[model samples]
Target: MTITYQINTPLTAKQAADIFISSGIKRPVEDLARIGRMLEHADILVTAWDGDQPVGLARAITDYAYCCYLSDLAVCREYQQQGIGKKLIATLQEHLGEESMLLLLAAPSAIDYYPQIGFEKLTSAFLIPRSK
Candidate 1:
């Protein structure tokens, strides 16, 4: 499959919502508004499209200088393992260039995947809500 990348400026709220949910990245519904805000005001967002439909999204917040946090990355389930995710990350890395620090908090299942995409292990602090 051919993968094409597009830089979106303030992507529709619905697309952002789908990426928040379908990519298996958990976030509260209340956060959708914040995602919209980020879409409106942060670094460029790279989206992969198959025909006219959006199949993948990679969102980042970057200064294009010292640091870039790759916060949300997701591709449709039917589209995994096809190098779409890797291509998205590669595209983001190219945008960030060589000197910037690229970082993300990987989901437990995704720990192995990130390293393969050029991310190294790093110790960081995090907090999660306790299950009732």
Candidate 2:
């Protein structure tokens, strides 16, 4: 399958929600308003499309210079074992260029996946749990 990857692609809440759910990335999909705002403010959004269908999405918040937080990386369940996820990331890095450092808080299940794609483990990270 030839997936077309695009940077800063505009997506509807339904499109993003469907991708997040199918990819098992646990987001508040039922709340379209919140999801809309999330997508509205993101500085970077990379998406993979199978013609008219969205197969993957990677959303991020960045300054376009020093640091970028890849908040979400999701590929449709059927499309998961392929290189789509890695391609989404590589596209994001390409947009941010070499000087920017890309980071993400991986799902527990994905912790092992990142390192295989050149992400180094970080010991100095911390987060306050999201209360929802």
Candidate 3:
């Protein structure tokens, strides 16, 4: 499959939700408005496309100078293990400044995957649980 990557591409909430569901990412896909807001507020968004279909996505909130929080990374199940996720991350990194540090909270299923892609495993991170 010939995959094409795009940065800051316009994506409808439905398209985002579809990939979330297909990728097995635990997102509120039923809530289109919330999904739209997520897209609206992200400072950076990278997507992997197969022709007209979006097969993967990465969204981040960053200062583009100091730090970048990689808020979401998802690859459709059918596209998983094909390096689409890695390419999406690489595409995002290309947009970041040399001084920027990338960070992300991995889903339980993805804990091992990130390290394989060069993300350091950290024990010092903390989080306040979100109330849905």
List clashing residue pairs in candidate 2: none
Q: What is the lDDT, from 0 to 100, of the residue 108 in candidate 1? A: 91
Q: Model 2 over residues 76-112: C-alpha lDDT tens digits?
A: 9999999999999999999999889998898899999
Clashes found in each candidate (C-alpha, N, C closer than 3 A): 0, 0, 0
Clashing pairs in 3: none
Better of 1 and 2 by TM-score: 2
Backbone clash total for model 3 is 0
Q: Is candidate 2 or candidate 3 better by lDDT?
A: 3
Residue 84 lDDT (model 1)? 90
lDDT by residue (27-74, candidate 3, tens digit) is 999999999999999999999999999999999999988999999999
RMSD of each: 3.1, 0.8, 0.6
- Displacement of the residue 37 alpha carbon in candidate 3, Å: 0.0
**What's the C-alpha lDDT at position 26 in model 2?**
91
Q: Residue 130 of candidate 1: its Cα lDDT?
A: 54
RMSD of 2: 0.8
